[model samples]
Target: MILWFLGLMVVGLYLSFIMMRRSLKRSALIIVFGIGVVGSLLLITLNDNAHFGMVKRTTTNEQTIYTASPNVQMPMLLKQPAGTADKHAVYIYKTDPKKKAVHTKADLAVRNEISRTADTTASLTSQTTRWEYQNGFYGALFNHEGAGQFVSQRNQLAIPKDWFILTTTQAKRLSAKLKVLQHPTAQQKAALATKVKAKAAELVKAEPELATDQTTLMKQAQKAVQQQLIQQAVQDVQQHK
Candidate 1:
């Protein structure tokens, strides 16, 4: 609709210019051409302003709330209350620090347990450790973080049950590890792959349901890991350059 209006304005201006060049009566040409030019300009300005004005109005009304740490932006899922569009009416609160602390401790313990078990059989490489973390409690915690963000942003207290098992600290730690893997040495990469395979085997043994679809699961896991690694590598290069 806006595009059509703009196109019409352009065509009107072009026609007005052509008419001024061809018309024999100078006064008549000036008056007609002047009206066309002024009308087109007014229509274009009004239409553009109306479109942009709506966007600005909507954005102002739907305020995006963030936690104390700017890194974690909460999802907007709540609807505005009946008969109210006031920004001040929106509820905002900090995430519970004590709950987050407890969850982080539990998540660390789980990671340690996995590392100890993997070590008893063979030396765990960075890659293997990453795979294990993704396939285990770390993966579960990621889901919680997502859910927590949604719940918190909506000003709701009832978070996902899984949120009680992981915290923001664990999520940050996993993110740091991923960044380190972005620029691994060749030997480290090889070691990581070997460890990953070993961890996958361990997972199959521990989870019988995964045994039936192990090949498919491993392929999916590998694809997800590689995509993240590639993204991290690109970010690292761009940042340094």
Candidate 2:
């Protein structure tokens, strides 16, 4: 859109020179010159506020959320920053269980929202506001300068019930306490290991394909064992109190 204004301004200058050489003999040049000046100012005004030559479009994308046990359908760990509680922050998650975590794009013009879903799928819906030419004439005139320029964008993410949202600050502070709660004595470890193996067998029996996948089965079993240990720790603490 700015290019349209600048091009008109340049044409207006060229017309001024032609009018000077012709010494006002070509009266038709006056109308052409007037058009050039008016068109330039009109484009400038439109680009400034009205944004007549542009449109906003939206798109959506859905991806699988990584879990502790992919085959067994374990809870997902969604990491966020401390600042996220007050304002929008970057989200880090993995698309696959074995893949590295991916961070969302952080920018001033970018906004983010989150919604909860009943199932386990994660989705990101992006609404981008860019300067798209309304017609072929505007497309040609403003094609070279800032064509398809980004105005703003908004991302809406759908959260699932299986997601365990954790803030970085909270995770750091609770690191030691969580270790204490999850840790077990030698005897406890022996017993917990037996329970975990039994749990793995039970889950595999329910989903037969996990019998060959050691990693997912082990993760699921370990997670269940850790949760039980944490609950036992809390009970012991209450009893002592």
Candidate 3:
């Protein structure tokens, strides 16, 4: 591509100069002038798009999960879709407790995926591919014209097993359900106690190590019960499923 661009400009100028000196016909001048114009147009197009003289680079980043529960007891992982449909996705999270929630980019250049992990801490690793001039020569030509620009990025989130993933729409359902569950009625309290006991037993059977520590066992059980409730809410609210 570079060779072609340079060749057109150099050859066109050489031919035009020779023709002018020899007093060539008007048609000869027009052909060489057209060559130069074509070459100039190509340069303008490449410089505008910043498509040439770029390299793809990958980078990774990690962020700790933020839990809004009072005791770090209920770990909630939230996600929001770009639109009513579930095609383009983005995550809502907070890397710091003090800062406001952060939403991942919803631009066409960005993509996201999630996976489960056994660790209690959640993290996000991103591979960003952007355009960067190959060297100073290309940079000098296209620096202010967007030499280095965002192309695309893929984010992979590895979340803890204990963390419950809920969409924003489902979260609203969860909030309403919690208000009802927190009622002072005796029946609701009894049912919650039963669910916690059942979830604890199920978890212990799956991983027997949790039974060794009574405090950790109960915490895990509490988290499990809440997660179960959220899962039910997700089912109730997901119309696009």
lDDT of 1 at 159: 28
Looking at model 1, residue 220 earns an lDDT score of: 52
Best by lDDT: 3
Q: List model 2 lDDT by residue over 61-171, tens digit each.
A: 555655432323334444454253556676666666587667666666877777788966776666777776677776665553455677787777777865545444443
Q: How many clashes in each candidate?
A: 0, 0, 0
lDDT of 3 at 163: 74
Candidate 1's residue-wise lDDT over 19-138, tens digit each?
556555655655665665576556446434432112111111121122222233222111112223322222122334222211111121111111112111111111111112223343
How accurate locally is residue 167 in candidate 1, as Cα lDDT from 0 to 100?
Answer: 28
In model 1, the clashing pairs are none
Which runs of model 2 end up more than 4 angstroms from their true locations? 1-24, 27-31, 67-79, 82-85, 107-111, 151-154, 173-178, 185-225, 228-241
Candidate with the greatest TM-score versus the true structure: 3
How much does candidate 2 score in TM-score?
0.58
TM-score of 1: 0.23
RMSD of 3: 6.5
Stretches of candidate 1 above 4 Å error?
1-157, 161-177, 207-214, 220-241
What are the per-residue Cα lDDT tens digits for candidate 3 across 1-241? 4445556666666677665565556457656667776766777687666466667666667667575433256577777777766677778877787877787788878988889988878888888877776788876654445644788888888888867677777667766776665563888678888988888898889989889987888898887787677667656665532
